[model samples]
Target: MPQLPCQGCRGMCCGPVPITESELKRIRKYVRGMPLPARSKLEGQLRFFGTCIFYDQDQDKCGIHPARPAVCRAFGLHRNLVCFRMPEAASGEAWAAGEPSVGVLSADFVWNDFK
Candidate 1:
């Protein structure tokens, strides 16, 4: 699959990510395992309103990428999750959650939620 041109976009398309229970648990574990300095840096970033809490604005990528939710991993590869900058990357059918979402990352969850 083609990669989205995520660099230089600065997480403009990453926002309000919906997370399932397992995804939340995994993210919690990942955040807890991160070194304080690194976590602090990620949490300290001033992202645009509604941007994903784990989006590393300074680095222009996901801060907890390995633990990101399934929907996030499927992004830009489904009709519904198209990246405007790379619309062609999206194909096939729209994405649907395999599990019920516990909450949205940036909205219902926050920096303190992971800590």
Candidate 2:
């Protein structure tokens, strides 16, 4: 797979990501496992409205990358989830979720929900 041109994007495309129950559980575990300082820093960062709650704006990457939702993992690779910065990387096939979304991150879910 090609690397996304994410360095300068600051998670501009990570708004309101839909997540399943399993993904939420995984993220809860991932957050709970973080050291207080690391977790605090991540939780303290200010982001643009509508950005994913777990986006580490300071690091310019996903704070819970290892536990990111399925749609995020398939980003820029599926036709329906194309990255505007790298549209050529998207394939013709759409990405299908293995399960239904329980909530939308940064919307139905938030920093408090992960705590």
Candidate 3:
């Protein structure tokens, strides 16, 4: 089957991306030369349930797409892991409509499972 194009999805996959040890290392190295604000944003993303540092909410795209983690690259590519066409939650509209979106992965879901 053909995979759904992820464009215009507003980064639903970003929130659940599992950062592995090696990916963390790569992200650290990549962010070392970035400005303070950018680095700080990345650091903050390390917290559980926070959005991925590379996700640009404003632009709705990955800031570090070229070097994104393996989990990120593999998201929605498999039979059991396909992306869902949920209503956009960029605003409160989806919630206002009484259709609460569900997260694909839990905040405490072990990232090591994918390694």
Best by TM-score: 2
Specify the poorest-scoring 10-residue window by lDDT in model 2.
Answer: 106-115
- Candidate 3 collision pairs: none
RMSD of each: 1.0, 0.9, 11.4
Q: Measured by C-alpha RMSD in angstroms, how accurate is candidate 1?
A: 1.0
Runs of candidate 3 with Cα error greater than 4 angstroms are 1-4, 35-50, 86-115
lDDT of 1 by residue, 1-115 (tens): 8978878988887889889999999999999999999999899988888888889988889999899899888989999988888889999789999999998888998888888
TM-score of 2: 0.96
Residue pairs in candidate 1 whose N, alpha carbon or C atoms collide under 3 angstroms: none
For candidate 3, report its TM-score.
0.54
Candidate 3, after superposition: displacement of residue 8 in Å? Answer: 1.8
TM-score of each: 0.95, 0.96, 0.54
Candidate 3 root-mean-square deviation in Å: 11.4
What ranking emerges by TM-score with the best candidate at the front? 2, 1, 3
Write down the lDDT that model 3 would get.
0.51
Q: Model 3: per-residue lDDT, tens digit, 1-115? A: 3445667876666775545456655655655556878645544443324565456666667766666766565455543444566322122311121222222222533333222
What's the C-alpha lDDT at position 30 in model 1? 99
